[model samples]
Target: MPVIVLEARDFSSPIFLVRTLEVISGCITFSLVASLEPPKDPSDLHPTFRIFCMFIWCFFFTLTLLIHILSIIQFHSLIPISWKNLTVTTAVLGALMGLSASVVFPWMVIDHQGSLQRPVAAAVASCITFLAYSSETCILRTQAQEQRGYMGSNPGLLKILQLWGGCNMIPLVLGVVQSQWSALGTPSGVLSWQLWVSAVLYSVCVLMSLVTLVVILGDFAGRCFLPFDRFLAGFSLIGVFLYMFATVICFTKILQLKEPGNRASAQMTELIIMETVVASITLLAYTVDLAFSIKLLCDRSHA
Candidate 1:
């Protein structure tokens, strides 16, 4: 008889340590949000913002916690794990945490009402948290690429994800620019030229997603190096949903901005909703797609 012994090694991975810190940061932010008093002024701030912030914080906290637990299991040799999938998840978490750092400011405003200290500290902590996760992602990715020839399932889907990811940056960058320079004040309503710009950008995002879905599906057999599975379809659908929702939100915000009596507080609320929804969905879609692809790669490696 032959004996085979498998020892778990995930805890020794540097990525595991980074994920632990990320979870801690999420918990700190979540606790702070929970302890804050309810919004005093309904007109200036809505309860929904606080509720949304809490939801996001909780989501991040729970996700990291679960991932950490799974890592521990894999480390103990209780189960096998895919390093590539974990790396993708970490990369996605880094993106979401970066967005979380930005998202905290609005909640800070509602919670602290002009105090700079608490919000700044939280934001800095969140930023550092993302940086740590990002560092881990880079390290894992470098290691993977060194061990494996390339990181993706096939050249085709990899190209699509790369292009799609790059295109997404367009909206992200433009939104940042618009927010920073928004005080210059553009025209409102359908007459708002900036509104048209937003409309066009989001429209492109939608069109691109749609086109990607069709192209990937129509020729999936020929193009995919891996099996054409439901995961690919699900991932493509998420992309489409993300772009469609973003397009609708862009138009809605334009209309809201044109409203005669719309308060600045209301505008800020709308912005928060839009940014949070878009960022969350985008991060989720990317994470799932990469995770599935990585799973396939892991299967190959195991085989």
Candidate 2:
């Protein structure tokens, strides 16, 4: 008689491998967009739009890459939380960002029935990456619904949150309106549909941010720093930062133009750089905030 034993594979290993593939795909996408030749005609896809799209892909991909690398290296254990849960969340985020990139990269580059090869290729690559990340996330996921009640009677904290939100929203609303007006008035050199989509999304983000602040302001008896609460707070703050960034970029563009018909050529480089910097910061904030919230949730569940 002989006895045989089977060893179970580490579930986290698959998550790390999928994330690595996502990182590689993201790098490919960044390279492809970065190397794309600028359209010669002003009526074609604007270079600024391309630059913006590229920065977005770069930002998310970079964050996804870094966090997953840390997870793979077991660095996430430094936090007082379960590493598997964090890995699952990171994978989920990677999948979502991959989906966004798939659609946006192609849409941003499509113009005048020109060559769609690059965009198509990039979209396919990202789609595959998305599928991989999503599958791994599902595998590592636990049966936890992320929900939290309202905060306690903390008026001071509520006021501070409201004040901060108002400051962010005021500038953001102004910027969104300004950008929308400028694009509609001068739709020739801009991505018309993209501007419209951006306006709509920005409007929604503003409303959500304000609504979350209101939720925080309402009095209820419970711990406010719950995982889901942190999630909402973090999401609102990220929206505020993004909106402010948009405002700054729009105002800069407005300032650069000398007249109605004149375009701002010299400011493109600076604006692109600014977008990269702000996007990096926003993504980092989002990742950390989301991670903390999940960590808290996992801890509470166990307790």
TM-score of each: 0.51, 0.47
Q: In model 2, state the lDDT of residue 37.
A: 64
Best by lDDT: 1
Q: Give the runs in model 1 whose Cα sits over 4 Å from its true position.
A: 1-13, 43-46, 73-83, 104-116, 145-303
Candidate 2, run of 10 with poorest lDDT: 147-156
lDDT of 2 at 145: 32
Model 2 misplacement above 4 A: 1-12, 42-49, 79-86, 112-115, 142-303
30-107 in candidate 1: lDDT tens per residue?
676565556675443335445545565576668667767755554423334344443454355444545654554454
Q: Any residue pairs clashing in model 1, and if so which?
A: none
Displacement of the residue 84 alpha carbon in candidate 2, Å: 5.7
lDDT digits (tens) for residues 148-250 of candidate 2? 1122122222322333333233323333334444545555445454345445545565466455544443332144555545556566466556555554554
